[model samples]
Target: MSRVAPQGVLKSRRFRDYLFMTVGILITAWGLDAFLIPNKLVAGGVSGLSTVLYYTLQDKGLTVPVGVMMLAMNLVLLVVAVSFKGWRYGAKTIYGMVALSVAVDGLAPFTPHLASHDPLLAVLYGGVVTGIGMGLVFKARGNTGGTDIVAQLLADRSNFGVGQMMLAADASVTLVAALKFGPDLALYGAVAVVIMGRVIDLVQEGLSVEKVAYIISEHSDRIADAILHELGRGATGLSSRGMYSGEAREMIFTVVSRRELDALKALVHAVDPGAFMIISDIHEALGEGFKENGV
Candidate 1:
């Protein structure tokens, strides 16, 4: 009975992951067909390469489907994913790639095209929509096998990092786009890529601005107490040795939202005017007082 319950919960979570991945793929496909494809905004991915190839073939009187090209490209990349990350990661990537490719093509016929055909609007809106979809897929711990595999492989083989490798790949794609589609449209595509990157970060991290403050004060107990009572936040005191002074010290540490920063500072000041404080940004703070676990 106990084993059965755990198995059921595991299955439920897996089902939810698949559901979110599917929906996110569909949304991404819609954004591509409706806005990006129509305007030739190749935002540098396997999808971007597929877009460029789709048009190039069209000009050559070949009516190859963009999704087919993407699927073919992604299938080749899947080998790298499997080899590097193993079957667990490869399985999700395979599913994501196939689903996204099929969705992009399947939805194209019924998907309404952007009537205005404005390049700028297409880039802006398409980037946001596509980014949101990608973010959802990422949140579900899924990814479409594309340049990601290549980037990972390159990072492992070389000293350059994954981010740098990904950037290089995207830049190469953008350069190809410029040569094929003209400088103006390529520039728009590049802008779309940048916008998409920002939107993805926004979706993943959210807008919450949590600040972490470290206070070095002689009156550590008073400052810690003030932080707890006035700020309504927990504070920790760490014992440290001041290397420069060869003296023992207590450092106060606390995390609070941006809104409470001024109040925290005021409290710290009142407790110890001579206190040295270092404030920094926290990308995320998950736990008791902040966001709940698994949220």
Candidate 2:
């Protein structure tokens, strides 16, 4: 598992990662420029602060591109990240940051403004798109610079969850934005962040949310095989015993998507009417038919 690739191959893979990160940056920039910027709605994080500053400066007749501000802020955090976290930690971050900064600036020129009358609709659209872009960057093993670096470092040194740390940082930025953008805008930003948060989960986990099925039946083998052949999903058989009856039996475990739920249930019931089954939601079902390797 701890193997290093050849230098040439490593460089090639690095380039590919950079390419994907660039696409993510471009998509993120388009979302911001088109939906969020036009409607004065913001999500949390470095991008959110940049949006606030962009409009703040706009009011002062000074034109500072949001991307440029983002780059500057990220550079400050990048330096701090490297100073404490080490060079290797910041290397990919630097590459991602620079590429994202440039892509955001470059793509802004071409991105169309949605100019939607409803601020809520714009927030939803922008949040989802930006979340997708961020998810792609994460999938490529790239960083988004700014507070992500700081949050990651902090999360690593403590028992806190990374998501929680990130949320704290993002909420702080939105709070600051509120002081300048007004209370209502702040609330709108929060709503946007909520939407974006969910979208990021969906993108990273794959949209095909699954349901895990646990079966306890007399003929567990038959049900498991049916699930495997009919549903194209793997099933595990476990040794289980009846608590009250003092009899041993086999239990089956399988995961399938929402569309396959009815079929899976039907299959188990058809095989054994007395089959006991449990189903639960799977937030992220990676591997196999889920997210592809290296993505």
Candidate that would win on lDDT: 1
Over the stretch 1-295, how does candidate 2's per-residue lDDT look in tens digits?
A: 7666689778888788778787887788788888987677768888888888998999999999888998999989878777886786646788777877777788787877784787777888988898888777887788778777768878988899888888888889889878988888888889989987788777767655689988999889889889888888899988888989989998898888899999999999899999998899877776888655552
Q: Candidate 2 clashing pairs?
A: none
Provide C-alpha RMSD values for all models, in order.
2.4, 3.7
The worst-scoring run of ten residues by lDDT in candidate 2 lies at 286-295
Q: Largest TM-score belongs to which candidate?
A: 1
- Per-candidate Cα lDDT values, in order, are 0.89, 0.83
- The ten-residue window of minimal lDDT in model 1 covers 81-90
> Over 4 Å off in model 2, which ranges?
1-12, 156-159, 225-234, 242-247, 256-260, 283-295
